[model samples]
Target: MHEKNAGQNKGERHLMMQGKLNRGPIEFKSRPAERTGAIMAISTTNVVCVPPTMSICDGVSTMTREGFRRLPITDAGSGQLRGIITVSDIVDFMGGGDRYNLVKNKHQGNFLSAINESLRSIMTEQVMTLRENDDIEDAIDLIVNKRHGGAPIIDDESGVVGMVTEHDLLKALFQGQSLLSVEDVMSGSPRVTNPDCSIAAVAQQMNKYHFRRLPVVSDDVLFGIVTATDIMKYIGSGEVFRKIQSGDVSEVTALPIRSIMTGSLQTTTPEKSINDIAREMVQKRIGAFPVTEDARLIGMITEFDLVRTLASR
Candidate 1:
C-alpha cells in the first residue's frame, strides 16, 4: 500500500505517509523512549489467522467470536501471510464505500451472495506489517503516522508471530499511575450518531471520519453506542440474514442503527484520572469510554487519546 505513492513527488509522498491521503493532516505525537520489551510484553502472541478460502461471513464470525478488530489471512498450506481484514474493511464491503461494488455489480445486488464471497474479495492485499526487530517506539511511530489502529507482527522465518495495536500500547504506558486527568487527554464533543440513523449512514460516518465507534444519542442524551465490530457481528451472527428476505445490501443497511447498537455503556468523567481510566479499560476490556457530565454526553476518552498522553508525557 505504501508503494502506491512511489511515483508521487517527495512532498506528496510525505502527505501520504502522514496519513493525509484522504483524511485531514495528522497530528503526529509521541516517541516513547520505552524499551523494546514494552511492546513484546504486551503483544498478543500465537496470533490467529484465517485461510484465504474462508468465506466472508465466516471471517466476520471469527472476528466477532474472538473479539478482534482485525484478522490476518494466511496460506492454508504454507501458513504464509496473504492479507488482512479489519472491521473498517468489512464496513466498506457492507455498503459504506466504493467496495460495495462487490455486492452491487459482482453479485448483482445480492447481499447474501456477496457476503458468501471469499475473504480475498475484501481483504487488504498489501498489508503494513511490523518486523520482529522493530522496537516499541518504532511501532508507535509507524502505526500513529500511518493512522492504523493496529498491525500484524511479522517474523522473517516464522511469518506472523504476534499482533500489536494502539490499545496494547496504551495499556503498557499507564497502569493507574499517571497524574493526567481524562479532561487533559479526552477529545471533547465527539462525533455522535442517533439510533434512527441507518447502518449505511453510520458506516459512512465511520469511514469518512476514521472513527471505529460512534455514540448513539437522542435529543442530546446518550442512548447507546455503535461500533464497526457491532455491525460486523450483526452479519456474522446471522441477525442480519434473518431480518432481510430480499438479501439486498440496502435492505440490511437501511435498518436503523438501533437494531445493532449496544445500549449498556461504561462511562467516565472528565475529571477522572487517566490512570484510573486505564485500569478500568484493562479490567473491562474496553478500548474507549464515553465521558459524561450531569448525565449528558460531553466527550470521549479513547485508547489513541491515552496513547497520545503517554507520548506527550
Candidate 2:
C-alpha cells in the first residue's frame, strides 16, 4: 500500500485496520512538479467497498466504522463499480430530501424496517468515476467543475482499482508555497445555522447549499459547528437507534441541532496562508476550518478550497 510504504501516520494507521487506505494526516513533502504523475500516485488503492446487496444499515455501519464519508457499491461477483453512497445520502434518507419517502411512505414511519432495505434504494445509481490513466489535472477538473467530493478510480474492465478525494489532491499540492492566504480562497459569508435548528433542517440546509459543514451562530457569536458527518455519526453511534423508542425516525430527527453540534472548534484567521492551513488540516485531521477575525465568524475554508487553490499552483 502507498500509505504503508510512505510510513503512514497514526490516523491512517488506524484506518488501515478497518480496510481504508491512502487517507491522511499524510505529510506533504514532494514539490508539485515532482509529484505530477499518474493519479494513482495519490489515489487510495485497495479501497474498502460494499456489495450492492448489502443492507443499508450494514453499509452505513461500515462507513461509520471506517470513518469514511462515502462508500462505493460494487457487484459482488465481478467487483465492478455499481453505485456510490455518501453521508449526504444518509442525511437525505433521514428526512433531508425525497429519499425520506422510504421512511414515511414505504416503511410507514418505521425506521428499523426502512434501514433494512437494500443499499440500492439509496445509492446514487449514476456515479461519476475516474479512469486509472487520468492525470491529476483531469481529477481536479472533474472534482472542481462537477463539485464531487471524490471519485473511484477504475481500470479497463470498469472495476474499482483506487479512490481519490479532495484530501488526496490537497496533500499532493500543498507544498508550503504560501502564495494564497485563507481570505483569498475561503467562501465568505458562508450559510450558517442557529443552535435551535433541527437536525432535519440542518440536513435540508446542507443539501440545499451543497455545504458539508455549517457554522452555528447565535447573537453574533459562534456557538458550534455541524456537518453531514455529525449526522451520520448520530446514526452510526447507535444513539439514534437507542433514542427511537417507537421506531419513528421523527423522534430522533426532531432533536435540536445543538444536541449534536461540535462545541469545541478549531478555527483560523483570514491572513493565514493556505499552505499553513493545509498542514494544520493534516496534523489535526480536520476537514475544514471556520475563519475567525477578532473572535467573529467571517468565512470558512475546507479541503475543497485548498484543493482549488493548490491545483492552480
Candidate 3:
C-alpha cells in the first residue's frame, strides 16, 4: 500500500514543482522586512469593532457577512473593554445544542432583539486585551498561546481604542506590519480530508487545489494534519516504499491512512495568540497546527499563513 501511494505522490509533487496548478497569479515577491515596515505604519483608527451589549446574533451576522472572525466588544457607555466575540466562541455556543436550537428558532427578529435572544446570553467576558504601544509580538503571543482570534486594543484608562483581528495580522504579514491576528491570514473553509483516505487520493486533491496540507478528520472530528512534508518523508525514507516499475501487487491494498500519518499532534484554539503559536511551530519544527474547539477541528493554521501575515506587516 505504501509503495502504491508513493508512486502516486511522486507524480503529484512533479506536477506541483512544475507549476502546473498556476496558484500564484497574485504572488508578491517582497521580503519580510519590507512587509513589517508597512504594518507598523498603519494607523489604528480604522480598525473594526463593536460594543459589548451588542447581541451575539448581531456580531455573528456582521462578522459572518463581512467575513470577520473577531468583534471587539466594549462597554456601550464607557467604550471600555468588556469582552470579545469570536467565530470560535460562536461555534462553541452553537455546538451546545440548546443555544443552537434557540438561535435557529429566532433568526428573523430585529438585530437588537435577535442579539438579546441569541448572543447576549452566550457571550464571554474575561477578554484578552492589548495596549496600543504593546509590541506586535505581544499580540502574536496572546493569539498563539491563548488561541485568540483577535484582541481589543485598549488605552491606559482601559477604554477600548482600536481592534485587531486575524485579518489585520494577514494584512500585516502581506504588507509587512508589526503584529497580526489569526483572522489576518486564515483561509476560511480550507480543504480537508479523512485520515482513513488513501495517500493517492489525498495527493490528487492537494494537487488539484494547490494546497500544502490537508487537515485530517475522522467521524467529523479533527484528528491531525497531513502535508507535503509527510509525503516527502515517506518517499525519502525509502523503507516505507520502494520504487516499482511494472509489477502489480495483489496483497497491499487495504492500508488505513493512520498507518502512515503523524498521529501525535499539536493544536491551537482560535483564542490563542499568534506569538505563542509561532513559537510552538518553531520549537516543535512543525509546519501547521489544527484549530479546535471541544476537541473538534474548526480550522488549520500553517507556516505559510504566518509567513503571509509577516509579509503584510
TM-score of model number 3: 0.43
Report the Cα lDDT for candidate 2. 0.80
In the range 1-313, model 1's lDDT, one tens digit per residue, is: 1222456321111111111113233243434445555356778886789999999999999998888999999989888899999999988887778778899899998999998899998899899888777787767786666778999988775478889998788777774355567776778756677788888888887887778898877766778778898888998888988888988888999998888876478888777878789878877778899888777777788888877667555
Q: What is candidate 2's lDDT per residue for 1-313, written digit by digit as tens?
A: 1123255321111101111122223233334645446899999896898998899988888888998989999999898999999999999998888888999999998889999999999999899999988898888998877889899999998799999998887877776565567777777766677788788878877776667888887666777779898998888877788888888878988898888865378899877767789998877768999888777777789999888867655
Which 10-residue window in model 1 sums to the lowest lDDT? 11-20
TM-scores of the models, in the order given: 0.86, 0.87, 0.43
> What ordering of candidates by lDDT runs from best to worst?
2, 1, 3
Cα displacement (Å) at residue 129, model 3: 1.1
* Runs off by more than 4 Å, candidate 3: 1-44, 96-118, 174-313
Give me the runs in candidate 1 sitting further than 4 Å from their true place. 1-33
Q: Write the per-residue lDDT of candidate 3 for residues 1-313, one digit (tens) a residue.
A: 0112344432222111111122222333344543223223432455456775565545666664554446666666777677666544443332222333443455431222333553456556787877777766665666555555567778888876666654455444433323444433445454566667665555556545555577776556666777654543442343233532222211111244455575487777665656666666766656677776566565667765785456333
- lDDT at position 177, candidate 1: 58
Clashes of each: 0, 0, 49
Q: TM-score for candidate 1, please give it.
A: 0.86
